[model samples]
Target: MSFKVWMMEIRVPYLLLPIILSIVGGALALYHGSFDVVNFFLFMAVLLLLHITVNTLNDYYDHKTGIDFHTKRTMFNGGTGILQKGLLEPQQVYRAAMGCFIIAAVIGAYVVYRVGLILLPLLILGMIFALFYTQIFARNMLGEISAGLGLGVLPIIGAFMVHGLPLTIDCVILSVAAGILTFNLLLLNEFPDVDADVPGGRRNIVISLGTKKAAKLYSLLTFSVYGILLIFTLMGVLPPLCLIGLATLPIAFKAASLSFTEPNVGDSFFQGQKANVQMILVTQLFVAVGIVASLLLI
Candidate 1:
């Protein structure tokens, strides 16, 4: 397959999550006065590969199961349209996904050698999630949970620990905020796919809760992201500057409002999805920057 085709298969825009997650994790490390440049880069490399594996493997499985064919594709939720368009063979995508998983494992091994076995569990969990997410987890109600833990909470915590910093309450609080944001990301994206997913035997949040209830849940969790940050900051669990993450609240509120008022297939829905994405990225980024700023100011 051409490199362009491969990039499309892997869904490059989603790769930004890994980069931002890495920064959040690394920033947590920096906040605690531990900075290891080598370990940080290694951690980032692993995040990127794991993200690619998730994208490619999900595409491969979705194509095989006819999910992609039925899915109403969107910039936010649907699998990359590469395989359905016959741009890449399913086997090619699967093999590439496996290749990424293997490479990420090897790098994770080296990091484990240097850091300790503490990270091995997260690495294994991430690989499992990447492989089984589409085939198994999404079919059950566990898809959102798996995505949040495997991609969000676990990776951020692993990023923090890779710098040889001990996990603390502050690190965990930040990781949970990341996880909730991720959970909302996957949950909201599922809105457009409910009809497609039911035929595919998927039982994700939107499908199980129905769209309106799920929309309320999404709005609740979206607000909770900032709620947790605010509560923790006031309780002295997080730095005061972490409140900077709330700067994205307007975008988040707009997204939530649209979720309640707009149909899932309309332009407003797409706008809401875009706003959610913007909020997710910038909130995490602002929190990370706040951590660094706190460190510098201290």
Candidate 2:
């Protein structure tokens, strides 16, 4: 396949979400132990493959459902334009997704052997969610939570686990924050597709709850992320330097406020979609940076 076709099919840009999550995991690990560059990159490859699997499979499923056909898509909210344009056959997309999944599984198995079975739950959960997401979770108001936990929380925990140490309170606490940021990522992005998703049989949180309530839920979830960080910092669970995460509050607020104030869906909420994506990515980036900064200070 050509580079553009691969990029469009795999939705490579969205890989940023998993990339940042891996950073959050690796950085939090550094606070307790020395960095393992080889192990870190190995896990990164596994993550990228899993991310590719999900993106490809999601597009295949969405295309089959005709949702991608009817949706007014933007850069961030739509299925990768690959299938919609007939750039690749549906079977090609499905096969590619399976190929990515097998590669990630082999790598994950290797990591499990090297590290222990501690990562098994995360590995299993991530795969299950990736495979079934478009068919089941996307219809059960679970797309947002699944995205957060799979892309956000599990990666952080898995990142920390590969170092072969027992998980720390700080690791768990930080992972939750990372997960919440990821949840917001999908939560806000869903608004633009609610119309298409509803008709396509996707009962995503936005479609199931109505954008207004989903918007409020977005606010609550976004606010809770910072709230967790601040509380943990005050309790001495997180490093003082991690307060740097709070530096992102203004942008996050703008994202949350846009979700509720703008109140539209199916492409009309494009600005809100942008704000929400910014909030999700920027907040997690800062949180990971905060963890790494503490390591640097020492």
Candidate 3:
């Protein structure tokens, strides 16, 4: 296949957004003199690569498990552009996913070399979790917990690798807060996919809790993230202005209310997917703004 064909099949451009956001977050943390620039950049690169690899793998597996078949017609969003669109064979998609994972492993190995053997196990576990998230095993049972640990704790490990031991409690708190925010994003995204996911045997939290309860869970997590920030500020850990994240509360509340009233109201999978994506992007923007404000004001 031509390069353009492959790119189109994988939706590679859309993948850049998350990679860029992650790099921005990591860079912002470093800009505040949190760690060595070189090491921080390397860590960011590793994460961005891993995230892209996971996205690719998800596309491949969603197709492998027949999730993409009905996605084209129903209220289900399709991934693995190749499989969904019939541009590439299943084996080809699988091979491409493995290639991305291999590249991520190389980057991870370097991180281990720079840090210590302690991070190796975490790295291996993370890779496995990434693969199994939508692949061979549906650990969707532990989705929230895994999301928190993988997104929150793992990034903090990356930060510490560059900064070294005797880690700052402040960073840890920020990391946990960031992780919670990330987890909520994932949770919200799953809302629209509940229908297709249930039939496909992908029963995640949304499937287990049902749409109404899951919507409430999303709302609770959204508010709780800012609430935790406020509490931290009261305790003098986070800056008071970090509560600027509350600025996005109106948007979040609107999304939550809509989600609760019409959990799966979109006309099609694409529309539903768009709604969930909007929530996640808006929340991330608020969190990013909050992070910047905290760094400056605190």
Candidate 1: C-alpha RMSD after superposition: 1.1
Each prediction's Cα RMSD? Answer: 1.1, 1.8, 3.5
What's the lDDT for residue 56 in model 3? 66
Between 2 and 3, whose TM-score is larger?
A: 2
Candidate 3 lands at a TM-score of 0.81
lDDT of 3 by residue, 60-141 (tens): 7777677766553332235545666677777886787677678778977887787677767768876876666665444447
Clashing pairs in 2: none
Number of the candidate with higher lDDT, 1 or 3: 1
Q: Candidate 1's residue-wise lDDT over 113-186, tens digit each?
A: 99999888888888898778888898889999999998889988999999998889988998899999999999
Candidate 2 per-residue C-alpha lDDT over 1-52 given as tens digits, one digit per residue, 9 for 90 to 100: 6888988888877888878877877887778775777778778888899999
What ranges in model 3 sit over 4 Å off?
Answer: 2-32, 72-76, 136-140, 239-241, 267-298
TM-score of each: 0.97, 0.94, 0.81
Model 1, residue 110: what's the lDDT?
96
Best by lDDT: 1
lDDT of 2: 0.81
| Clash pairs, model 3 backbone | 75-269
Model 1: lDDT of residue 81:
92
